[model samples]
Target: EFLENYFLGIFTCEAILKIIALGFLLQPGAYLRNVWNLLDFTVVITGYITVFAQTGTGIDLRTLRAVRVLRPLKLVSGIPSLQVVLKSLIKAMAPLLQIGLLVLFGIVVLAIVGLEFY
Candidate 1:
């Protein structure tokens, strides 16, 4: 199992590297930023197929929960779309976060006043 998994990893890495080399060498798809996301999707789908193939119609909800826990991996795996999305969300929410903190303080103050008055 270890050897098979190791070889599969090497094969996938080599294939992805070849495609990236070709992209650079041929200057293809320069406009798209999430080009590498396709590779991540391919790898993840391949993993799911392998697991299902080995187990034969028996995947529990707990197993699925663990799998879904990796949902953020779609963003964290250096895929450009996810990276840019997280960046944009942070940028957009910075001021909102600050405002939320102020709101929280106001709520705390109001709660204290109500407690003291009542």
Candidate 2:
């Protein structure tokens, strides 16, 4: 399944475009370099449109259980600032976890000591 998706989407498109891009690359050079990138954009847009156009020829909201998750993750790829913020949040959460564990251990130790005195 992974191989099928890879060949269909990226690898196949890249292989074919590399052949065409070769001509432009050798002559007009990197200024005309953006053609390959545009081909990539075209392939991706066509793929997504084709997926939704399948079956009933329109996107079925009932079958899109994962759209909400997909939308945010896809958008996050374009946001370096958001990625940095998320990284900071994960790091900040580490001390909270350690403090929670230590507080829990302290409560257990105190409970044991109080019980001994009683």
Candidate 3:
């Protein structure tokens, strides 16, 4: 718990610093303008929500803690190579989905043929 809170505090500080330096939403290169920063903001906010819920508030927001799993993905923003790879993967998704559907159709057709023969 101590370690979790420690890391949460670090992430929170980073988010605050970025927001201050880049501005929030209006500027051209604002912090929230970048998707990664938006994700970082979400993770930090969810962390606080869970902490407050567990500490003082009567609200049960434990499910929000599951979002903490995305915290590691924050590293992608720090690494340009990872960002490139991720963007490539996102671009490939539509073609990949089509290929996957084609393969599934072939499998289904073969299964139907085998059933008729048997």
TM-score of each: 0.40, 0.35, 0.87
lDDT order, best first, reads 3, 1, 2
Best candidate, TM-score: 3
Query: What is the number of backbone collisions in each predicted candidate, taken in the order shown?
Result: 0, 0, 0
Q: Number of clashing pairs, model 2? A: 0
Q: How far does residue 54 in candidate 1 sit from its true spot (Å)?
A: 8.7
User: Which scores greater on TM-score, model 2 or model 3?
Assistant: 3
Question: Given candidate 2, what's the lDDT at residue 64?
Answer: 39
Q: Rank the candidates by TM-score, best first.
A: 3, 1, 2
Query: Which stretch of 10 consecutive residues in model 2 shows the poorest summed lDDT?
Result: 65-74
lDDT of 2 by residue, 6-95 (tens): 644653465457547665345555313654344444445554554555545766554433432343433343468876886689799989
Which model, 1 or 3, shows the larger TM-score? 3
Q: How close is each model in CA RMSD to the real structure?
A: 9.4, 11.2, 1.8
Candidate 1 C-alpha error for residue 102, in Å: 1.1
lDDT digits (tens) for residues 1-118 of candidate 1:
7764675566457546755655533355521234455545455556556656667865443543354344455446556677787778879898999999999999999999999999
Best by lDDT: 3
Q: How many backbone overlaps does candidate 3 show? A: 0
In candidate 2, list every pair of residues with a backbone clash.
none
